[model samples]
Target: MQDLLDKIVAEANVTPEQAAKTLDVIKEYIVEKFPMLGGAVENLLGGNN
Candidate 1:
């Protein structure tokens, strides 16, 4: 994820926190639409399923 943050910072000209938040929102959107992926997302987040 550090690589992604670096890319976002360089290409999008955004802070690490902003990039992380954007990624989180996008991931949550996908999870909400495709609940089956909730498991994978939860695993990736290392949080509750």
Candidate 2:
């Protein structure tokens, strides 16, 4: 997910830590909104690793 992190850092003009936190928030929101997709989301996003 380094690619995603790089894109977010460049496009959003945010630090790496901020970008990571943003991703975490988004992942949580998606899982919360669609509980059934939690596994899929974790797989896709790599689960904050």
Candidate 3:
């Protein structure tokens, strides 16, 4: 989400590249740990666009 990315950029004071990587890792963890959710996130993220 753009709002989430904005918040992370401001609060974490990180570069765009770093923020993207961080978000990817966070997403990966969620998918890995919450197998039941499966592609729910991908769908949500896709809807965001």
Candidate 4:
């Protein structure tokens, strides 16, 4: 998770905190909209699914 966050921060030229918050919002949206695919997305995002 840290690795991906770092990559995003570098590539997007954003702060680490901003990257993290963006990821959190995206994760929440994905899990909410696609309830059935939540586990798969969570796994891909490095969550314990």
RMSD of each: 3.1, 0.9, 3.0, 2.6
Query: Model 4 off-target regions past 4 Å?
Result: 47-49
lDDT of 4 by residue, 1-49 (tens): 7888999999999999899888888888888898998988778886631
User: Over 4 Å off in model 3, which ranges?
Assistant: 46-49
What does candidate 2 score in Cα RMSD to the true structure?
0.9
Candidate 4 — which pairs collide? none
What pairs collide in candidate 3? none
- Per-residue CA lDDT of candidate 2, range 1-49, in tens? 7899999999999999999999999999999999999999988888864
lDDT of each: 0.76, 0.92, 0.73, 0.84
TM-score, cand. 3 vs. native: 0.75
Rank candidates by TM-score, best first.
Answer: 2, 4, 3, 1
**In candidate 4, what residue range of length 10 has the lowest lDDT sum?**
40-49
Candidates 1 and 3, the one with greater lDDT: 1
C-alpha lDDT of candidate 1 relative to the true structure: 0.76
Worst 10 residues of 3 by lDDT: 40-49
